[model samples]
Target: MLYIIDILGTIAFAISGALVAFDKRMDVFGIFIIAFVTAVGGGTLRDLLIGHTPVGWMNDLTYTYVIIVSTIFAIGFRSKLNYLRTSLLLFDAIGIGLYTLIGLEKGVELHLHPILCIALGTMTACFGGVIRDILCNEIPVVFRRETIYATCCILGGVMYFALGVLPLDHNIVFLASGTIIIATRLLAVRFKIALPNIYRD
Candidate 1:
């Protein structure tokens, strides 16, 4: 199940990255570059912080293949697709949702503290988009208070721990947490919900 989620998350992130690249009018190479980084950037950071050597993608070429295929799919279908902002939001939300669960599980396996686990989850979910935006010369959405991006990951991570105390099955717990994360993001976007800005003139 985790493997499936990881693959799906990679695909979603790769597509989202490719979309951003196209929106920026980048070339083919640039599209692939952005897709690659967005798909693996967060996971790489999580692995390094956890002292894991030779990140997951480095150990397997399947991830690379998936990213390439996803990039192509994104670019190939751009014209046929609606190119709606909501589509991008949905894909990004799904990627972050799965990534949050994956990161939280890894932290638990590594015997990390709950707080650290939450942090790892947030990093795993948001770092990829952060790098993508930076490379595209835009502000990282997660860094924006109004984005409600990383906050979704953090809330989902917290929900994971909360659900852990229940007598539900582990699979159910993970699914519920991830679903909540995705739903939160979609709702936030639909309702234009966000944290209040702290900056004042």
Candidate 2:
């Protein structure tokens, strides 16, 4: 199941990147490049930060192929996505939920301090989109105080570790953690809930 969740997250981010490329009127290659970056950027950063040499996609082509296929499929079926209005945000939330667990578990395996593990988890869930926005010449959403983007991951990470001592099944913990991350994002958007704007004054 972890593998499946990872792939679904990959596909979601890939679609989001492709959609951004399409919005920017980029060519097919540009779309593919952005999609690939968005799909693997955060995980690669987490691996590097944790001293996992060569990173994940470097040794395995599975993620690469998934990104490629997802980009193509997203571009081909994009008209339907247009009608959804919030497709990009939705996909991004799903990506965050899945990637957080992957990073958290990797940190746990490396025996890092629990708080740093939570930081790693938040980075894994958000840094990809940060890179994506930077490359696309947009402000990184997580850097905005009013967005409540990465905070969802941070709060969800806290929840994950909080639940760790509860005697629940590990898989249940994982699912609940991911759900918390995703739900926070979705609900925040739904209610326009966000941190106070720093520049409002």
Candidate 3:
């Protein structure tokens, strides 16, 4: 189940990265590079921080294959992809939720402190996009005054840990966490909500 979620998240993030590349009029190779980094950057960072050798995609060729396939599909459907804005947001939200949970689980497995686990989860969910934006020379949306992005991931991670103490099924916990993250993001966008800017004061 976790594997499936991770694959889905990778696909979504890859698509998003490809879209940005396309928007920038990048070449095919550039698009693929952006897609790969956006899909795996966060997880790789988390693994490195936790001392997980070989990282994730380094150990799993399937993840590499998935990102490649996703990039090809995105490129092939470029003309028709303009209508995918809403779909992209949905996929991104799902990715963020799944990544957050997976990061938390990995941190716990490493015997890290709970707070560190939550931090890792948020990083796992958000840092990929941060890298993507940086590479594309744009300020990361996650750091801007947009709707809650990383905050939603952090909240969902906390919820996941709290529910994990119960006798609930693991799938149930995943669903709950994913749902909360997605709903929070959607509602924030719908209402034009945003966190206060630190520089404002």
Candidate 4:
């Protein structure tokens, strides 16, 4: 189940990255680069911070293959997908949720503090999009005047930790966390909810 979630998250991120590239009218090589970075950027950062060598994607070729296949699919379906903004948001929300839980799980496995684990989870879920936006020459949506993005990951991570103490199945914890994050994001979008921004007068 964890493996399935990881693959789905990777594919979602890859598609989002490819979409960004397509929007920018980038070349094929550029599209692949964007897709690869978006798929692995967050996980790679988490691994590096946790002192895991070779990172996640570098240690496993399956991750690389998944990203490649995902990129191809995104490119092939670009025309059809152009009209599905909501579907793309759903995929992105799922990716964020899964990545958050995966990072938190890894941190817990390493015996890290819960607070630190939550931070790691948030970073793992958000930094990929940050890198993708930077490469695409756009301000990251997470940092802009938009609905809560990283906040959803943070809240989900906290919920996961809180639920971990319960006599619940591990999979249930993950599902709950993912569901909370995705639902929050969707609701935020639906209601145009947003956090207050700091601005210089």
Q: What C-alpha lDDT values do all the predictions have? A: 0.87, 0.85, 0.88, 0.88
What does candidate 1's lDDT look like per residue over 64-155, in tens digits?
99999988888888886565556666767887998888888899998999999999989989999899999999999678777588888999
lDDT of 3 by residue, 28-82 (tens): 9999999999999999899998888789888879988999999999999989887
Q: Give per-residue lDDT, candidate 1, residue 82.
A: 66
Tell me each candidate's RMSD, in Å, in order.
Answer: 2.0, 2.0, 1.9, 1.9
Alpha-carbon lDDT of model 3: 0.88
How big is the positional error of residue 199 in model 1, measured in Å on the Cα after superposition?
3.0
TM-score, each model?
0.90, 0.90, 0.91, 0.91
Candidate 1 accuracy as lDDT: 0.87
What is the Å distance of residue 120 in model 3 from its true position?
Answer: 0.7
Separately for all candidates shown, the number of backbone clashes (residues 3 or more apart, or on different chains) is 0, 0, 0, 0
lDDT (C-alpha) at residue 127 in model 3? 92
Q: Which parts of model 4 are misplaced by more than 4 Å?
A: 198-201
The residue-level lDDT of candidate 3 at 50 comes to: 82
Clashing pairs in 2: none
lDDT of 2: 0.85
